[model samples]
Target: MSEPDPGLSSGAVVAEPETLHAPPPRLSSPLARLALDFCASRPAVAGLAVILVVAVAAIFAPLIVPQNPYDLAQLDIMDGTLPPGSPSYAFGTYWLGTDVQGRDMLSAIVYGLRISLLVGSVSVAFALVIGSAVGLVAAFFGGGLDSLLMRIVDIQLSFPAILVALILLAIFGNGVDKVIIALVIVQWAYYARAVRGSALVERRKEYIDAAVCLGLGTRRVLFGHLLPNCLPPLIVIATVQVAHAVALEATLSFLGVGVPITEPSLGLLIANGFEYMMSGRYWISFFPGVALVVVIVAINLVGDRLRDLLNPRLQR
Candidate 1:
């Protein structure tokens, strides 16, 4: 038995020493907590940093680059094929060299990234909206409607996405809008399939039954309830698909069925430099290719991290 201390005499009030515990970690809001979790992964953090820098550069291309590659007045013919760090007669130094058209590689890449991101993001958003609606309607109705939609999705998915995009582009002709249309056409099926699977699982859950039983409108239950719950996987897919859309667009542009020559994306820039690759002038294609790779890899990294973060089964 523990001996009573002399300081604690009979009839005297004695205070017990409090046990110190680290205060329970304060619960943060979801967004803040998500940010913190994302930051905890080094690769994700690095990828996000790269994406932010590239996005900012692309957004402010005109202000960041020495010259606008699009403006004919800014290009000097004699400056064509200048190596990286070579000084131009009119446009100061060519940091990443020049293409066959005397367009600054750096400027072209920055501008091209802007276009690529715009097309990819817009196409993905469109696909997401279309796909989600289709999936929700299918899952909610089930039976014949679900079978019909799934069959269409299966038929679409059976074909390679790039090949589908190529065919669509060939039919639509070359332009930014056309390329986006092609991409969205090829891409939406994947989202529909994904959303349908998730929605199916969620449809079987108790809350969905409750919502259905409560006489909720189809729009309210599907969009307001089912759609939000299905978003995690859809978000992961969208993030990764942005990279695919950019790559597909680049491929189409490289193949000459993408954006018109008047507007160059990274692929067009690479195609322009293809002839020069044998001539030892590599900066034009090489730099743009590197930029595209960086963008895709960074996006994939972020997507992978998000998948791991959002999927309980994948959590460490």
Candidate 2:
């Protein structure tokens, strides 16, 4: 009794070694890892490489372009329709040829890409924020508001995106900002629909219930707990929508209601060359058209990759 039982002694009792689970091997960021994974697929890597090259070229347009295509003063009507690699061109030789205005085809493509990227990026961003907000609110607070919003979304969806843009442009007049606004109006519904669907699921989760029970405000619950979970889908949607938006912008500009003649977008360039396309002056429209296709295809490739990576259901 004075010595104490051996089993009860602290020295006699052996403790189990603490097992530290190695933090689940750090997975690279969704985008970074996905980009790395793209190398596994030739097509994905090709698409990614195309985007990077185009981006770099677009960014360095000022340095690389022989002259600003937009500067009307520098253009020569004689240079117009000069075939690609034509020695007859005023600059001695031209790659991708020139439009009716003799603006460098390569330069125009670069400049047009920049504008397309800008308008597409901005419009999608605007739409994302507004749509996410509307969707979250509708999901968080249903009834009349939900009905009204969802019905509006349905109505908008009934019409084509192009039709919506055309109508809005007609009412507002043509310009980059106007096109962006129209796109946001037309596209917001899709985002809203997506976000609302996500929010509906998230709102029903036990965490949301716990948050509500803890006296968390609607703002905190809606944004803090719910929004982050909803982003992967939204991000993938946004990436694809960028291609859609760029195409739309090009369409608007081609229709003479976008960016204006002075600031030619890819659509406008294509339109400008359309007249000469059959006349053997194909490069004018052909190159820009190819650029647009490439941009859209590349973006879709990346978007598809992102969807596969982020979506558990899609993982093979």
Best by TM-score: 1
Candidate 2 wrongly placed segments (more than 4 Å): 1-39, 88-92
| TM of each candidate vs. truth | 0.93, 0.87
- Those runs of model 1 whose alpha carbons end farther than 4 Å from true positions after fitting are 1-20
lDDT of 2 by residue, 1-316 (tens): 3776678776676655656644556556876676667577777777778888888887888998787889878788887777888764345568787778778888889999988988988999999999999999999899999999999889989999999899899999978889899989988988999999999999899998999999999999989999998998998999999999999999889889888887858999899889876788888888999999999999899888877777878775
Determine the C-alpha RMSD for candidate 1 after optimal superposition of all C-alphas: 4.0
How well does candidate 1 score on lDDT at residue 315? 75
Candidate 2 lands at a TM-score of 0.87
Clashes of 2: 0
